[model samples]
Target: MSMRKPLAIFISALMASSAANAAEVYNKDSNKLDFYGKVVGLNYISNNKAEHGDKSYARFGFKGVTKISDQLSGYGQWEYNVKTNNPEAMDMGNATRLAFVGLKFADFGSFDYGRNNGVLYDVSSFTDVNPEFGGDSFTKEDNFMTGRAKGLATFRTSNFFGSIDGLSLALQYQGKNPNPHKSEDRRDGNGEGWGASTSYDLGYGIQLAGAYASSNRTDIQASDKNGQTADAWNLGMKYDNAQLYLAAMYAETRNMSHYGISNNRYAKKTQNIEIAAHYLFVDGPAEGLQPSLAYVQSVGKKLDPVSKSGDAADAAASFKGGKQDLVKYIEVGTSYFFNKNMYTYVDYKINLLKKDTYTSATGVNTDNILGLGLVYQF
Candidate 1:
């Protein structure tokens, strides 16, 4: 009875039959077309870069809607992500996670344009609940709360002053980027962003989230052109009772800059945290499985310079030399599940280098990471 125990008991009873009922539609008269996809693969290891690897991928999408009359409705999605790592270059060139189009105002909510995801990434994607991997916060720093800002544009709302039960709201923008992001090592540019996010579901399981964003040609330096600015904010909490689940998140990033003379400085200040809990074992032998744990603590500094000083001892003599910072760590293992589109997992991460405070005991442990993966969302 090996072979993953009959494919984990045939994916815990016929995959709980779903895939959104296998979308693929094409209604005639009223006009409708649908299709969707998802796939992720992994097999990796790292004891601070010892290296071991495996990869996989597949992602597809397409959607449609039409009913411009009975109160408006029109939607779309064209997603992309395909690269079998490298089986003789099975690469699919550029990756487009989501292409959008929308207009749905049945109860007053929806407005979209090309290149999706903003709204501070829909409130930090709800702590990014790890399914088979470590939680993600806009890939760590780069996202900085702009949350997938790819020439985006958006607006969403529902349950604002109407009832306020499980309220919702989102707003975003990222105009101007027609090939204006450059890079040498890393200091690309092109941004004129705006963002907002909110969520509430004070139900028995509790929920609350928040977000904030700002941008101005986000550049990581290399002489920040268009003069930097990338603000961010976040908050989170969650508690689910489908057996057990918990969440936490915190974010803060500010990258204000102005070249020389320490003008409006900030140069980058950061803080990020993540936490999670899981427990699901519905039946026997880990029926449908689920054993998860996650934690992330990121702290970065060295640009406060007296909080953008305005003469606080002249910013303490510009730090009188001596400052270095970096920190990130986490341990997450189980993320088991064979339902909700299948699952599997493992992960570990650590990196410590904090020189003038924030103890790491003389620092030594480096970029450690180990990962195991699988995800099958169709």
Candidate 2:
């Protein structure tokens, strides 16, 4: 859950260019400054039906804003991701996913500290925006509610339940700073956590969201029976207008902590269900062209062993105990748009792991994915 996402992108494009009529880089009079950024990349191919692979990566970000008046404002951002399949030594600690600096309150609402994004995964952010991976996969996932955490601090709100106008909300916290170069009991995501989310816009396009989160694993020393605490929750629904887009979600997590569970550190309990839809036929010949489909499912059981490695091979993998681990996923994609900066895409995913009877590799991340990408937004 430390994948680092959504830094609320430079305070939502610096509040749409300082609340309108703003394209300044230095507009003297009433004070103004703005700057935005974008750059993304995705390249993929993998068969895993024995073996076949390809990889790619590219990322960059930018943002700047300053408007201290008419309600106050300030912003900053910095992003990175250029590993191109690991160019030998490119760890850069984390390639600085986001630098962070923020404050905005046109009427009250906005704050960011360091690393962000973790309001319980923003209610599944509409199926994780399916541009590539869907919410970072699951099953014992360490996706900690869609990743990103590091002395985090967040808060956001809008219409928070007043003028009825599309209510919104967010809250987050992450702390346990103590990385004197790792190993201080090493439990970055465990020591502290907090989350919250809310959304509403039940009008035409429909939208409703919910989220909740918790964390505390202090390296799991609470007389372990599966770490001390870890929690999650979600509920979502989305519907978009122009061209169509639909989303559905119901998520759950408990104890989680994955990236090789049973490989030990033990944490489990999961359940995920998703539904997705996409469309874009903007009129004529499949206008901008868009097509997408999705269906995801995850289920889990088996977990009971804070001691016992008798026949290790993840000893009866998939959790063990009473056994149960269902997984099914499907994703299809397409996107085309040769204008507006740029656009191009292709995806095909398939993940199935409904097998049991002890197979290990610690629950192989079932696969069958293919992808192509090109996106540009200014």
Candidate 3:
């Protein structure tokens, strides 16, 4: 077999595990390294001033693998993001997105530790493919074992030890994370937690996935009349071929969702739903064009009632112990790929939130957003 064939296979495997576009830079003595990055010039227009602005950013990462033996291997990855919209003198919003090192045992599984995505994302990610903004249904960064966070030990196995053709399983554990700053929200702090996820590929480009996570809340977080434990679960389904993609997910969280700023409070419960579809035109005049549509909604239930007292901070605080709509929108977009390395996209988010007393008091945004962006990746 030619080296080109194995290199192509390795690249394809990496693409399946990550979304970034990468190119192999070295492959010698059973050791390999790949470099990947993307630069996006993006802008959004919305009636809400906070949401209207430039959103340009650049992200880069590297992946390396060393084969210790035929049955054992070592691998690691590091990725960072830089916000280019900020002035040179100001904070550019630089952050480390992913950093992990792992060991893989052939035909057994892989174990890794470091800051990485939570197991719950295994299911929620099915509907998170919208171009601009559609993954706001409960998965949040730095919020316990939900999206991306720190201090996680994860173990993953594919094909169930080679007995099943399309089954995958993952188990994760998270250590307690103390708030770095005193003023930070208690919701950012978490106690010990664990999560599990499973997925089955049913042939013909169809797959089903589910995940569940539970964690202990910090003392301050549990002091606000909320439960001591935070729990979440998600179920999702997706179908994908070379030309089309479709996905949907439903999730619920208990004592996990938080809202408000100055007088922040946690929602006792939250329900979320998301749906998405995309079609790519290939081998025609419209080749390299893809159109996307999606729907996303999140509602908070059993919220604590707030009294409208004379305090200035309580002026806009009002809840009647009922469910509140956190997010609701329909997104439509299209992307035109100029080639394998470049693409441009336009996305319009039609805000479906209604204006009412609750929305007004809670400061929920009801303005539509239009986003445009150009991207180059290698």
In model 3, which residue pairs have backbone atoms overlapping below 3 Å? none
What tens-digit string does per-residue lDDT give for candidate 3 at 65-176? 9999999999998889999999999875798988999999997899999989999999988888767878777888778878989999999999997789899999999999
RMSD of each: 19.1, 19.4, 3.9
Q: In model 1, what is the error at residue 377, expressed in angstroms?
A: 11
Candidate 2 vs. true structure, TM-score? 0.30
Query: Which candidate number has the best lDDT?
Result: 3
Candidate 1 residue lDDT tens string, 255-373: 62221222223346567777877666666676666666777655545543332244435533234322334345566566666665667777655444333322222222455667777
Using TM-score, give the best candidate's number: 3
Worst 10 residues of 2 by lDDT: 1-10
lDDT of 3 at 254: 91
lDDT of 2: 0.60
Q: Considering only N, C-alpha and C atoms within 3 Å, which residue pairs clash in candidate 1?
A: none
Q: Which portions of model 3 miss their true places by more than 4 Å?
A: 1-20, 261-263, 306-317
Writing each residue's lDDT as its tens digit, candidate 2 over 104-170 gives 8885688888865567667665776555656544422223445655577888878873455788988
